[model samples]
Target: MADLIEKILSIEGGALAITRDTAAKLVNNLVQNGEVKPEEAQPLIDELVARGEAERDALREDLAAQVTTLQNTTQSIQTMLNANIKEAPERAIHELVLLGEQITNVQDRLREAEKQVEENTRQTLGQAQKQLRIAQARLVQATEEIRTGSIDEA
Candidate 1:
């Protein structure tokens, strides 16, 4: 009988298992075992049943509180997700706009670099042509002096 009581009481989360019927049955078994007499059975049964009811009520309250807390947390998370979902498009657009501006800047810099390269190439070609012309004129003057009597007199 003591062992039975201990086993029932020692169970973890036993409030869900301990009902009025189970309490009465246990008390009846204790009476049959002569641990409790027939006259004492009713009071013991009532007390055990009441204790089970109290435990059940307490468990029900705790479960209700936990359910409410879970619902509130779920609502909060849903609201946050909804807000993020709403803002996702805006964020993407903002990022794309920034990327477009950066691309345009890069294109402009590339154009400027190309223009500078072309100008430098043109200037280099012009300088080379001028130098060639000067060298050709000097060579012609030397040829004329050699062909005429100026070379013999010098």
Candidate 2:
């Protein structure tokens, strides 16, 4: 049983390591393909990793806290049921309302993160498009000069 647990832990750790490496590779590829500036690549990768880890940590903590809160609420409800409390139903309703608000807050944060990623992608694509246009123009100018004998072939 101990060995099995160790194996499971190792696999989980490996998965996280793989995820971090994959994120870094993606950023490096973007830099190599000129979609991201070379100077910004490392910092971008670092930020990506940090954000990912932070988000994962936040989610884990949130889940644990929610579970704990629910357990406490369940216990409280059980106590109320045993005691025949008059306000039990209202208290349960209040707890559910608070849980709904928490869910909404999490959803809002997720939407904001998604929007940030979308904006960054748009900026990168815009830069790539601008570079392509400049390269295309230069190619046309070079081709025209060669055809007009302005640049003689060696």
Q: Of the candidates shown, which would achieve the greatest TM-score relative to the real structure?
A: 1
lDDT of 1 by residue, 1-154 (tens): 4454556556624545666677777767878888878887776666656666787899899999999999999999999999999999999999999999999999999999999999999999999999999999978888898788476444
Q: lDDT score, residue 142, model 1?
A: 81
Model 1 ranges off by over 4 Å: 1-33, 149-154
**Candidate 2 wrong stretches, greater than 4 Å:** 1-84, 152-154
What's the CA error at residue 3 for candidate 1, in Å?
Answer: 6.9
Where does the lowest 10-residue lDDT sum fall in candidate 1?
4-13
Candidate 2, lDDT over the whole model: 0.74
TM-score of each model, paired residue for residue: 0.77, 0.40
The true-versus-predicted C-alpha distance at residue 112 of model 1, in Å, is 0.4
